[model samples]
Target: MEAPPLERKLAAILAADVEGYSRLMNGDEEQTLATLTSHRTIVDALIENAHGQIFGTAGDSVLAEFPSIVHAFNSAVAIQQAMWRANQELPEDRRMNFRIGINVGDVLVKNGDIFGDGVNIAARLEGLADVGGICVSRGVRDHLRDRVDATFEDLGEHSIKNIARPLRVFRVIFDPEGDPAIDLAASPVESPETSSFVEQSLSQDRDSDDEGHRVELAFWESVQEGDDPAEYLLYLERFPNGQFVELANARLESGGTGEHDPGIELAFWETVREAGNSEMLEAYLAKYPQGQFSDLANIMLGELRGS
Candidate 1:
């Protein structure tokens, strides 16, 4: 006799995996295994706290289902935040970053494991998240407008693997300007930005403490000399706990290049001029308080009173 059809339901699903699990394992198998085990323990607890069920897991990937979309989104953010805190003490290479994706849709359930396009889409969305970041489908984002206390930025439509239609994706902005390694824009598929960062750091690894210190000094001096935000970001990616991490972060947040993009400033002005509303000027100031035309924007804001 043929088996009966599997149980099915609409649910919110989350998929997550270590961003550089393969490379980390290849670099140090034993240590990688231990670290993954520890991280899984933490993730499992967080999932439960959010009232989600871990339906499946692979070597380094986690699949969980939540009854509520908000719960699932909150859980993803919490997990990343917790991992960020835990990673503070770990060295650059030893630190593990996770990419998470959440979606809400119909799913097939059999023997407590969830399947179907819902799960598949969530997994694909995970591939689009930057290291230590979250990406959610339009379905998930739709429910988060007033429910979650967080920011969601539209990533526009993206073509994902195995999905015929392009998915409307949004990035869950946990910390917009905090860490470049974690805040960089994600590509449709996994981008090499984070991986290249990891590879560069790995290549600089040294067996001698003296040699490693010298290398660290060399990188630090390079960043100081260049005074480029990208160089500073690279420095932080390689040495999360380096002596200049705090300074680097401050520079990136303060527009380290010493100026805003002229194109961006011009576009902001154009937008405000076309709209001719206080709201638009307010938005301009909010995004760029010290923008090239801040004074003009403020004057416009006052002129368009109560707008």
Candidate 2:
């Protein structure tokens, strides 16, 4: 008998997993399984009805593929709504909620299983989603615009693991009562209260940017004084997204000499290393292929590959 040939398809992939599955299982394994069964039954029925194929399932997660992004988004919303209704009668502790992430991309299908970064990203975005909420990749978000009765909060670009590019993320907010009138083309979501949380995050970005520029300048100065490449990388971490990423990279390549200025380089490298593990790394790299400290970044690339 001949083996089955591999299948390939352009699919809108949806991945969902129970939030706090371990806690639920620890609370009551049997009951947790029961609730999972009930929830999965509803989700499975809805997906099938929407013409989606269940590519795979683990203990508390499901991966499905749909031909249309719209169908995938609608099915996800329906699942959430149904699950919400089902949980209403249950006690708070007994309620099981899920986070969902969807993306539209090409996937490899082999032996009835789907594999690739497309699927991996969906799973990661699902983790980023709020409990009982849906988050989607930019591709899916762009596709749903002006068509769905939903509001989206931009999570900005992310550097997800195992995925080559940075993905723009958006959270889908459903009213449950009904779709609210929302402007899809409006600017990204701002904090409703502009609380300290928002301010702090913004402040950090500004500070980092400023510090990064300073470090880039200092890096050249140090190179003039004969600093070591690895030592300089430490300082660069401070301003990973710093304005001098290009200059720093060029200096590293040319082996410029300077006094060791560790602070800025360290800060910059820390950020770059983190970016390598981010959902936005791919996007960042695309824009900065010959980025600052490109040589040292190899370490991060290795780490990410291992991870």
Candidate 3:
């Protein structure tokens, strides 16, 4: 007699992994492990809050299943945003970026783990995501369209590895222009501030054509002057329904100024040294061969290695 059929169900699968896990590990295995552990706390919390379950995870890869496509997509976005916040306090080279992929498909589940082409596709799509970016399968994109209140860029069809057929993919652009809180309809639960902002914008009168042109000119001038995100944000607050709302939001998401914080770099270097290991010192040297703390890091590394 044939064996009983395997358990299967339609689910939203999310796959994510560190972009440069090996390089990080090579730099400092202990610190990499510690950092990964801390990051997992963030990832796991977001997944749980989204009502998803983590079914499997390796050193750097995570696979989870969600009952709803919207929840899964939202979880991916939340994870990315949270990671970005966490990285803000970290040194540039030590920042950990995650690539996430989401798909809605039939999956085989057993023993608290999931498998099937659905998972395979998600894994493949994760490989395509940019550092700190998310990619989703066609099913996810189709369902998320207007429901998510964000822009989706169609990636067209592509043949991914180990897949029998070509698959259509799309990327969720995390371009929050003025207010990061302007998540639109993407979030299932809206905060009072966001609701108020939406209501105010909808109720406000459209600027006169001439006024709009002047505001547009001013927006462009601000951009030309290299004003920071806060400046663009001020423009958005002043002209909620302005012609340049989209551009302003994009600039805000790009963080206006491209300068790195030297204080953060110094703090990160100090933290690494406090670990008191040759590997940590090596990591510091690797990231900043000629940086402010490089001389001390090099001396410590040499002393620790007796070389």
Best by TM-score: 3
The digit string of per-residue lDDT tens for model 1 on 95-146 reads 9889999999999987667889999999999999999999999988888988
lDDT of each: 0.73, 0.69, 0.72
Model 3 lDDT per residue over 193-265, tens place: 9988987886655346445555555464555366577788788887787544655565566576322434434
Which of 1 and 2 is ahead in lDDT? Answer: 1
Against the correct fold, how does model 1 do in TM-score?
Answer: 0.57
Full candidate order by lDDT, most accurate first: 1, 3, 2
Q: Work out how many backbone clashes candidate 2 has.
A: 44
lDDT of 2 by residue, 93-202 (tens): 98989899998887988887998878888898899999899999888888888998888999998888877778899999886544212211122235577666787779
Poorly placed runs, candidate 3 (over 4 Å): 1-5, 176-307
Candidates in order, TM-scores: namely 0.57, 0.57, 0.57
Least well predicted 10-residue stretch by lDDT in candidate 2: 179-188
**CA shift at 264, candidate 1, in angstroms?**
56
Task: Give the winner by lDDT: 1 or 3.
Answer: 1
What is residue 199's positional error in candidate 1, in angstroms?
52
Better of 2 and 3 by TM-score: 3
lDDT of model 1, residue 105: 92
